[model samples]
Target: MLTQEQISAYNEDGYVKIEGLFTPDEVEELGSEMIKIIGDWGEETIGWRGPWREKYLAEDEQQATKAVLMHNPHFYSATWGHVMFNEKLVGCVQDLIGSSVQWHHTVLHAKPPERGTPFPMHQDYPFYPHDGLDFVDCLLHLDDTPLESGSLCVVPGSHKDGGLEHIMGPDTAPHLPTDVYHPDKVESIPIPAKAGDVIFFSYCTIHWSNVNRTDKWRRSVRFGYHDSAMRPVGRYEDKVESIPIPAKAGDVIFFSYCTIHWSNVNRTDKWRRSVRFGYHDSAMRPVGRYEDDPYRIDPNNVLEGNTNTIVSGYKTNSEAN
Candidate 1:
């Protein structure tokens, strides 16, 4: 569970980091499972996007294309399932989300050293906006990350502005206007973290990162979570903020979904690998397929032993009010 001080930091700055929440063994095991699944990705698993394989395929490349973030590892891998439903991980989220959580979605983001592409500044709300700012994303660090390794950068308190206007950039991703979000006004800050550390932030937070200039790979996993009553308010025109909540290997950080943040490209020669997962409040939200599906316990339940916190929550749709 998060301390009052840590929760205050999140409420005040839009993000907070909790140190050493996971054990070193658990972290190492997750890394191993990720490697096994990554080794098996091919035409059958990668879907279309054949050019991604032809144009950028390296002997040691992480994915077929940078655009393809691997989804639902837990569905195929038991190892991921354990990490996904880890009690400590879910309990912390329960405290912030204010109800029992539901499994949302997970994505794996890996950046190979030296050639990892740069992710531009953007907001996730444009694609997956929900009622108020109940959505949150956590970055689970799988390797040591430093500013030189293209760590995350974020704009503090930017989520309070609500959803800011954005436009599609050359890459077809929705992004803020560079002129208006200038460094002078937005104050981009780099957040460095270690393996097992996690950084949670809001969906509306405006943020971005720089290219990694180190010789090692900077990798981490991300999990998106939401309250039980939250639902999608919009779709990706495409989609994706902030704070430097740093931690050592085995720690997890939680933040509001609207916090503005981003990261740089890995310039190092090491591989940066990370897996992503998510939890949601299922009573009023969908369980992957449909919106009205009844919430199920056990198997994927994160609130297994922590039932006192469960409660019947808010809207199942935007028009409910």
Candidate 2:
């Protein structure tokens, strides 16, 4: 459990480094388990293929893709599960959480020496959004992390700033705007930790790391947890699969509002338009009353009669057709 002073630090700083949270033997065991598990399931090329590399790195000709990562190790090995639920670790989590907690997920973010990648300044909240702010992640260090070795750093107390907009794109992971939150401009605190140390921080905390210049592996496993009552708000990319419809000009496409759907962006000169109409069962009560929906037709866009009718062109069609 955290001491009063440590608790105060966490409360004020939105994070606190718990030195030697695990023993040396435990850290060594984690390292071994990771190696073995990685041998079983191949690691992924997790290096950012973006401008952050060019902006941060020292222009080394021989910098092989910077990092390797494995996700949800506990699903494959019992050792990870054991360590994830260890009494001491859970106790400290409970200390800050102040109630029953639920295990969210875990990931192993290990950076190899020389070209270990640097993460751009951003909050983890975008990656895993929740309704409440009690969600916290513990970065359990498995190897010594110094400033030169891409140690974790943060804009301390930034969690109190609440969630900020991230520069989300298809090419890159969610990060803060390059011009606004660049590492050179943002004031941050470097958190160099030993093998057994763990840094527990709120998900809203703005954090980033630099390229590992030292010739040693900077290995760490992150375990996230939240209050049992907390609810998650998932991003569309995280849960949805996009499949486009092969609709012709006159074809009408329809689907339930609950269905997850998306459309391809228009790139041609043709003005692709949609006239939508909605209906619901009268017996089924609405969760809330809504007004001023986009269902209305635009008067300016219409040529003459700004009719809301679906078949405005089909005026008085006879039975003979």
Candidate 3:
């Protein structure tokens, strides 16, 4: 069960980190699995080559990178999801968004030392379009997420104001694109987590990560979930949908779709292994995009010539009412 303080913190601050959420063995298992997957795919050195490898890699390289344990076939198995969706995680979501949550999808984000780039600041709603306000997400640390490794930074309670409008204007320092949103009121909060800690927040929360500058890697696993009322609008892939998928040996973090979030770049020499899952409200319905609208539209569908749709699935949970 979630404590009153936790609930209050989340509501007021837009995000919260729960400590000792996973056992040491579980974290080690997930970390080892990630390392193995990277080795199997011949990506052990991919992180050392620098940040652009993900984009510069050949189609085969990209495919190989995706084939690791984070994207391994095992995750699709019932056994995988069963372990990933544990009682504590499910209970937390129920406390936040009711008992009728649904699983969406998953992705693993690996950051190698000096190979990761700064993830630009952006609201998640702009990436994913749906109705209602039940989108939520979680981040589970597989390693110590220290400040030097580029911990996640967030604009507290930004979710409460709905998604912020951003413009791709001039580049910020370090040649990164600047995301200008509601200024004067923006405050960046660094969220540091130890292994086994889980961070949860609303989909509308504005968040981003810095570049890793340490010798060690900061790895984490993330998952997102929504109430039954939300559904995909426009093309699903183009629309951002969050899901909670099962994994055999990692902590799960679940959140909503409106949550704005991004990961930091890895500057360390070690590998950062993180997995992500997205879920949606079972009741969510798809809506198209409008050019003049102030709210976020499904970028994949709203942008011309892009047509990827969201995939749907139903995972039954006995705890769900």
lDDT of 2 at 170: 82
Q: Cα miss at 319, model 1 (Å)?
A: 58
Output the TM-score of candidate 2: 0.71
List TM-scores for all candidates, in order: 0.63, 0.71, 0.59
Q: Please report, in order, the local distance difference test score of every candidate based on alpha carbons.
A: 0.63, 0.81, 0.61
Q: What is the per-residue lDDT of model 2 for residues 1-321, given as tens digits with 9 covering 90 to 100?
A: 889999888888989999998998988888899888777885657476565655656666224556777778876677787876788888999999876998888988888887787888989999889889998899999999999999999998899998889977787788888788878998999999999999999999999998787889898999999999987786454645577787788898778988877675453445678898775442233332224545654434423322223333444334213
In model 3, which runs have C-alpha deviations exceeding 4 angstroms? 41-80, 166-179, 182-185, 236-321
RMSD for each of the candidates: 18.8, 13.8, 17.5
lDDT of 1 by residue, 44-145 (tens): 222222222222244454243232247766654777866767787777777766766765667776665654444556676776667667667777888788
Off by over 4 Å in 1: 42-68, 169-171, 182-185, 235-321
What would the per-residue lDDT of candidate 3 be over residues 157-230, giving only the tens digit for each residue?
78898755543333221111243432223567788889888888887888766556566666665677788778
Model 2 alpha-carbon drift over 4 Å, by segment: 44-46, 58-63, 234-321
Q: Rank by lDDT, descending?
A: 2, 1, 3
TM-score of 3: 0.59
Worst 10 residues of 1 by lDDT: 42-51
Candidate 1 vs candidate 2: the TM-score winner is 2
